[model samples]
Target: MNPEAWVALALSLKVAAWATAINLLLGTAMGFALARWRFPGRELLDALLTLPMVLPPTVLGYYLLVLLGKRGWLGGWLHEQLGITLIFSWQGAVVAASVVAFPLVLKSARAAFENVDPQLERAARVLGLSEAAVFMRVSLPMAWRGILAGVLLAFARALGEFGATLMVAGSIPGQTQTLSIAVYEAVQAGQDASANTLVLITSLSCIAVLLSARWLAPQRSAA
Candidate 1:
């Protein structure tokens, strides 16, 4: 591993960590709402949220480019009003990774919240617990393991995000280039040794995260 490899790894970790953190808050809240609240178009909302999981990466990238490009509606406003530019930057990579990895957390959190016994929640409410208190003390505790499993999976997904990141952030060495992009660049440049090292690191990291997720996931008892 060389300095470039280490830089890519560090940048990848930074992007993944930020993306995961954003999803943790958003996914958990959205999942809990989808699980607990019955509303019109709930299924439609879920499908839309999960769209990135099934959409081709290039398509997703195109969508992002359109939305965040310098001339784009949101992007134009952001650049003009806040002096912020997301496209072609590491921050854009974070956004791309977050969109790509969000479904994992959302789906996991929904399942976890749904699996929590409504009776227990009602009982807490009966015992004079506020809705927030009941959620913090009872709901969250029961659903933590499953939620954590989803979080780990999201982290792994974010760490390996390639296409969307590439399109939105581009491959700027030591800046926007992530582990996956690094591997691609290495292979393109015929740096087989570097590519091999990056591939090994990525595989090992993802494998470790997946195993931990499996261990943390809720287990069904024998029927």
Candidate 2:
């Protein structure tokens, strides 16, 4: 394998790993909240959460670029306050992947949280357990299999993310180039061997993620 290929692979792994980690945390929280709480705009929030999944990736990318570009509102504020810039960087790729993968995590986790028996939680509360404690001890453990499935799904989505990542991160080799970007670049440059190699790796990773998710899922009782 070419050294550049290795670099691309490493960077891709870094971005995907970080994206998955952040999404797992945020998605789980959002899923729990959406499942357990009622508030104004809750329905709107749910719709928006799933919107990215339905929207064209290019459109999503364009909007994200506008929102997070250097001169854009949040981007400018972040640049000034934190001295950090997301545009055309690996971090930007991670953000894009996270955005695209979030819905998968949120949907699975929300279903899992909803399926959890509220009676268990109530009993824990009656036993003097705080809400947080009840959630940590009873709810989370009971839903662990589902949460794991969601995390795996999100990780797979992150690994395969392309359009938004390309638009925001710009396929800069050694900086923002990921496996999907590398594959595209290789094909564009007529490097079939490299493209094939990347494709194989990505396909295998996706399969692994899917299989792992299935294996990790809780076995259903035979009816």
lDDT of 2 by residue, 1-223 (tens): 7888888878877888999999889999999999999999998999999888999999999999999987899998999999999999999999999999999889988999999999999999999999999999999878877788888888888888999999999988899999998999999999999999989888887898788767656453121
Tell me the tens digit of each residue's lDDT in model 1 across 1-223.
7999889989999999999999999999999999999999999999999999999999999999999998999999999999999999999999999999999999999999999999999999999999999999999888987789788989999999999999999999989999999999999999999999999989988898888666555352111
| C-alpha RMSD of each candidate structure in angstroms | 3.0, 2.6
The lDDT of model 1 is: 0.93
lDDT of 2: 0.89
Off by over 4 Å in 1: 214-223
CA lDDT scores, all candidates in order: 0.93, 0.89
lDDT of 2 at 60: 95
Clash totals in order: 0, 0
Q: What shift in Å separates residue 76 of candidate 2 from its native position after superposition?
A: 0.6
